[model samples]
Target: MSDQSSDASSRPGASLESGEAAGAASGTVPEPVSEGPGRAKAAEEKPARASTRPVPAQNAGPEVPKVPAYLQAQPRPDVWLRGGHQPPPGVLTRLRPPSPPVIGPGTLWSVLATALLSALLLGDGLGANLLIVAVPAALGAFFAARSAARRLRPWTAVWAVGGLALLAIPALREAGWPVFLAVVSALALGSLALHGSRSWPGVLLGSLGLFPSVAAGARWGWRGVRVRADDSRGRVRTAVRTTAVAVVLLIVFGALFASADAAFADLLGDLTPDVSIGDSPWRAFLFAVGLVGALAAAYSAAAPVRWDGITVRPGKARNRAEWALPLIVLNLLFAAFITLQLVVLLGGYDKVLEETGLPLAEYARQGFWQLLWATVLTLLVIALALRWAPRGGPGDRTLVRSVLGALCVLTLVVVASALRRMDLYVDAFGLTRLRISVAAVELWLGVVLVLILAAGVFGARLLPRAIAVSAAAGVLAFGLVSPDGLIAEQNVQRYDADKTIDIDYLKGLSADAVPALNTLPEPLRSCALENFERDLARQEAPWYSSSWGEVRARDILEKHPAQNHGTECYSLGQESDERDGYEEDSYDPY
Candidate 1:
């Protein structure tokens, strides 16, 4: 047995001899072992160290060296990683549990109040009710979310204010498109404000994601309820039981009392809301819209995703020659076009009409749409140029500014040319919805170009946000200006130029144009306002369904109602030269 032990101990790493022999290669010292009885007895007398450290298996691979605790890298507090258990080698993993939803009693009450207000005040029509619904919803969201909002920047405040201001447009104007724009823009701004999104793409994504967040909010609210079940279950049950008992008692006793007394039933009928089965679906829809919208706003404000981290990879940049060449050529092309346009504009119409062999109206219509399209395409080109242009050095930035600046200047000229064409077209023809709509769009595009030019001079980092805000402002301005009213005014003025008017066209205008159309003399006024007066007379609208424009129109029509000239106005419209058959294809601006 002694010989076998000796042989076993002779193996590498088994005894002191083998350790001493391999010390030069392994660079590690082995612990001393007792070779005799005396030494063994001494070892047993000494205190033993814990053997908590891992031991290698006999057939296992070579053990890795352990790093000292002091020398190993420490985990950083700010850094976070994501994955399940057994993460990949060299990868740091962090466990991030989703935050519990914040469904406090106040938040619940706010959501309920907003929903109730929406059901009562909205869906009658987009009138006073729109402003009424928006104000409470915004206030509810603000109160619910104010505590959790991370960075309520100045721009967020601006957006919030802008959203409320936009909602008021419906109460001010009766036009459908303007009201539609106001609602969409208000929602987008509200989304941006709730999330405190500053970066352009972040703002855009947050605004767009609001609709989908409603579903997420529902789940969040459900999870919150489940999480607090232990704390809230008894109270909820008690409240529900009390409410159920009260409702049952009220129904049974109220029915009996109503049968016993007619006066009491009449009072109850007046006190109760007149909610019919027909309106239940619509009111329910409005309530849901309000509830979900408020909850989603609060959710986003409390736990906004770090959307600024999302970056779009720019296109591979090109050298200055490659980038500047096409842009310079474009600038030259714009310059040449501008020179020609100046000739046509400055030399007066007589010379151009003679040269082109076209009528004034045809000449006006020919290039207006094309110029508008060119302006739009030029903006796209500038965007792509900025994306792909080399921006590595000061010289590169200067080059970008110079080249893009010149292009923008020339594009401004193109914008001017387009507007000029539209003016001429409007002069020859009469104003229509399409004409004014396109004109507004073209003007907005011009504003965007000017903004880009300013960004080139200042800094381009905030350009996207600036452009977005400008667009919102433009939409608000357009809605406020009341394009239909302007159309009516312009067409009425044109009636003076040629003693003929399209009374049929004016009759089709909304209540927004009533004030303008009312200025026409006698039969023409009656003919133009006949349809609007008739429509307003038919509506027995409540105060919530009344808009400023509609109310004004009603008062005006009441003071000076349309006369019974009917067929005489129609006969005059038919005989007028304004109804002369013109080719619509030639005049189609779009």
Candidate 2:
């Protein structure tokens, strides 16, 4: 803690710098050796300045200057640099002191409570369940960082909450499972990485590899609990163990006796239970383990250990021939493909389909995914090329730039093709949530490609920042559009054009679709309403699982009395109000 300058001599085993320094330390004038035959031979090598030159230090090691901790040796280059020999060194690696234990009693108790809450709230409708989960999850990060003496990046928390909102949003839940997963995963990465690792990409990679930490944290928690519970007297531990053994024996004998006697079985009834583990525990044991994992995941998220994230490969300069040949060839092929696409576009869809002798639906389904994959792979190729492209020579740079520009331009055509495919498919077969999402993704990809091209050509280099923003924007747009409602609207539009409305399918959509279905025309609306009412009736939301979606669904169904004509579950004039007087009493809010 004291401020004192550190120097080389203080460090044991450090090499001595000069004879003068050693002489100074000893305060002695050393006597010179006699000029023997060896001295004569050495003198002959430096005859011009033999006497003037300082004699080599006798038995002295080479001098090494002291360096402060903050002033370290030069970090190793990234792997991509110099075209690979060995893997890049861990640039951020440091032998840091072990972090002090976080002593936040509030944090510890809150995380434990969160684990219990998560366990209690499982199997509820996703909206409510996710809402409940996010609170503790976010708090977990805050607490963990606090414990580790790290600061939480505000934007990371913002993104995490935004993602959780997407999950909780009623209508948007049907935006496609994969889309939701991506948003949630991004949220997790942003939150964990905000304080977990040193670099953005590193945080991302490490966040995915956090299972080990989670397991360790859980084990740590359990160890902590055990350490506290084992009193020095040993009596408390002994009594607990004895009681546990007795309980197991009693349960085993009781079950056997009940099985032997039918009368006793009837008396025991539900108490005998259907599920038991090792004749000792109830099914609650499974629930307990789940709580443990949840606690572990939360603990690791909030207070992660030190992680050295992935070191990106260094960029290496390449020969002009290496950079030019592949890019030029690829660009030419892309140019040709794009030219053909443009020609076909001018000729119209019907004419092209006629030439190919294919049905509209089949043709429409063909190109969307392929074009998407090609565009994604194209970006990958551009990235790898950029990493290895030559940095020296104007001719090589110009060639790279020209080819890159052409490839980006051609890639736009491919993105457009993908969009067109989705459009054609939707036009022919009507829209679903997945189709709408695909179209949106395609549009976003187009915008991103435009950004990429602009950055590449103008030297703006906005790809990294642009990519994250554009992707998040695409997902947030889904929230704006309202997936369940959009699906209903598009399907209804399709029905209007060509009498093909599927009421059952519409009813089958999430609760978010309910309000939209209510807007449908006449008798059809009534049938859809009946289907939804019956379905919702069967999916009774337990009190703990109450969500905005469920609550609203309940209120809406109450307002729209099923006409009872379409549903087999209800007869004419049936009340159908079994849950009318139910209380939300299971949970204690305080």
Candidate 3:
């Protein structure tokens, strides 16, 4: 039995052999099996375990406390789970979307139309000019606002329109204060109503509507309150301070200048007109009130509107055509009205001449009818050219064709008029004035030809180009043949006759004479010099007036100059002709 036990213990797998071997190796029973077979195996197989006994728990001072569950594990971050992975540093995270592109023929056409309207309106009176600026600005604001909030577009439009209406008050000044006030009130109320909803747009509209009135009131009167407070001391103080400063400045300046030069005193005295301010304070106050009210109304109308998140894409081609047709029609209507007025003026000339019974020579000399007709004809031709010109084509061929046609028409008319004039003169007056008559006809014809050439060169598809060409032609022709081509004749006559002062001959002088006449004294240099010369000629005694004996004496008197005349008379008599040299050759004595 002993031998069997010994053999079993000595086997490698026997627990007794391991225990004895570990005890003999200076170790107590091998450390109790760890939590698993692998741990137990490791403990049994380790050389260090064979050399050491297990230290009892009591011997180790207070076995190291197991880590609390919360602290036992290392921290796992929340961001890592939530954010997936960190992006690279310095990379842009948010980018704006690309803007929609402007496309198609309508976009280009709209821009052109707006530009034309802007130019035309700008050329109109001050009121129209203001509208030109305001309307576009308002539209721009509306679009901007609509982009922000689509719902705000209507409100923005209302505000802009209101502002424009208020501004229009200054334009129609003939309308009394009541009308102005009513217009302003209606605009303000309408703007408010349009933006009644409680939104950002509404708030903006309300503020804008009130701001102008408030500002204007403050500007014109001290009635505006700067702050909401019970005490009035601040307001009173401000008023007093302002008044004191103004009075002090006025008094100081008045005293200082009182002792200065007479001119300074005169200027100071004239600073206030003789008109009395007394008993009219109410009128002045009313004017001030009206001004403030108008300004306020303007402000209320000009609020910025925002239409958020509204995108506007171009309409279809058919829609564009629809819009374009109306615009074209309107332009044509305007042109027609202008033409009608011109035609009326042209047809009225014969009646005017007949009523006046002016001789053809006198009529030709005056050139009032000729110039009036030319202007009317030029305008009519230009209108027709523009009307016929094609607007939406690829090239300016249509405009070119129209210009050429109009020019041809104008030239024909001028030729026909010249021929008619020649026939009338030869048949009616029997006057041989071909040189002057032909010169005038040639001058106008040359002008028309040059204009046609210019219009052809520029290829006048555009209205401005057409207008410029017509204006240039008109100005040149008027300069050349205006008043019977007197400008050219005046220089020629002056060269030949040493100072030809024919009052009747020089009646058609241009506004260009204003600057030249400025160098001379007022009354002496007046344009009335012509009338004075005419009166002098009429006063001269007719040849038929003399009796038989007086006729011979009168002829002798007409042949020689009067004695004791000044240097001016001597010079004039020397320059005069045999017909009336002996007459008072001096300046008018009356």
Candidate 4:
């Protein structure tokens, strides 16, 4: 409750209660540890014995082992740290078996409800729809943290804030696969702080597979569900089971009977309640599967399984030369690209067209994605070097650092080039949701590469965590920039300057751009509104497509009122109905 793990441990009986809950979260008996020949059997049995005892009260002082005189000068936490490189907070804690998260009725309800909502939201839905799914996830993670003896990571808070921002940004949501990748990346990094996993691989493993592992436990939950107990808790259970089976049989028969006759089926349909997961076997099966998955995640969130499969062995010497030489070569290639970019920057648009012999739009299109790929490739090279670079002579280290540093600095120029290219492209061809979203990501990744380079050069060993933190910061910053609104504003500005604009496309943009569209002038404004209204007409106010963006767009349209605008916003359906039996293809449906 205090937002710190120590407070829970301080309570009488809390540890025992936590242990019992943890056991429920897993519902598995831990295998007994085999003792070596010289080891005392009692020593091996100590933990089992301790677990059986009542938790000590706060007034009952925990005996602190006295530090040796030689070690007294060092701080308590740092006394054992001979190496200057400090591992992230939770890595050392992994030495202990992972405790279960804090789970209750609240945790179960939140998980199930959120999963149901999210399953229903499967589409191109963005804006608040993204936030709608994200908050519940963050809450589920937090609940697990609260249930366990681990405090939520400071990065978890960052994760939550960033998720909120990231989801709300309409452009990112519509960006497709990249948005999914970014979201997953954000989750993995946040869980590092959330679950207090120190290893990058462990964080990745746990976050990515949290659901699968938990869902795998569905086999455990299914144990009782599959078998009908004739004497389950005696006669009362048998009677209840019988009654339930009878009710199910009757309902099935009644539905079948009704369906045999049209009038009877119509009457039955009217009487039956509208529900999402009905008696359809497929729907029921899918719903049950989702429920199992949610329960599994909730269980793990309360008590997580540790990812010990791949243990990161420290202090293995890497071949410094093998990783080093390639980096030097790549750095030189980047230096060449950056030098060429500098000349182009100074020479302006005319020079770019003159040299390339391509028009402005074609030139802009050709360069941005190529620069983006180059930047991405450079990052991979840096990351690989960090992971595999040999630790050897001081001279090798110096050379490696200088090349990496130069690459990082040069990578910034590439980043700038990519951004300039994208800006030029967007200026020529008005902003789409994907372009806006990717531009933000490009800037963020560029920042991350810069951090990676800095860590590599400065000899700060927390490269993984720093990259994770920078990633979280980048996501948060993108949200803060309000990408959807910016794209709308910028595109509107482009329309003003160029005089050639896609009115239909602007109307097709997310509701975040609605406010910005109001600034458009004259007949263009009329056409834009007409397009928007037509699209809005096709959309129905159902839970599946519901979003704040839609709500805002509808509200804006309400004020304009088609009659006052001197233009008709007619639906394709309406036109079709008027010309009844007209060819379906006659309508564009735009």
Show pairs that collide, candidate 2. Answer: 17-63, 78-314, 79-314, 80-313, 80-314, 81-314, 140-302, 141-302, 144-302, 144-303
Please provide, for model 4 over 368-487, each residue's C-alpha lDDT reduced to its tens digit, 9 standing for 90 to 100. Answer: 878888888877777666666667788767876887888888888888888888877776556776787678778977878777676665756566556666776665565444556677
The C-alpha RMSD in Å for every predicted model, in order, reads 10.0, 19.1, 26.7, 24.3
lDDT tens string, model 1, 561-584? 999895688675565243223543
Q: If the candidates were sorted by their lDDT against the true structure, best first, what order would they fall in?
A: 1, 2, 4, 3
* lDDT minimum window of 10 residues, candidate 2: 573-582
Model 2 C-alpha lDDT versus the unseen true structure:
0.60
Q: Rank by TM-score, highest first.
A: 1, 2, 4, 3
Best model number under TM-score: 1
In candidate 3, which residue ranges exceed 4 Å CA deviation? 1-240, 256-264, 270-275, 278-375, 385-590
* TM-score of each predicted structure versus truth: 0.77, 0.62, 0.27, 0.60
Count of clashes, each model: 0, 10, 12, 8
Local accuracy of candidate 2 as per-residue lDDT tens digits, 1-590: 12331353354222222333354335443333346766544434432342344434653334444576567866666767785456643432231224335324444555655655555555343444555655665565566557766665654555555556555543234334534654465555444443344443634554454454455556656664565555333755686799899999988998898999998877776333232245333224434654454455445544554444345674888888877898888888888888878888898877988898876656767878888888889888987888898888787777777788788888888898888878877766567767876778778877877887777666644355455556666666666566777778877777676535656567667666777777766666677677668777887655445545556666788987656444542332122321112122422111
Cα lDDT for residue 221, model 2? 63
Q: Candidate 1 — worst ten consecutive residues by lDDT sum?
A: 89-98
Candidate 3: residue 6 Cα off by (Å): 99
Candidate that beats the other on TM-score, 3 or 4, i.e. the better one: 4
Alpha carbon lDDT of each predicted model = 0.75, 0.60, 0.40, 0.59
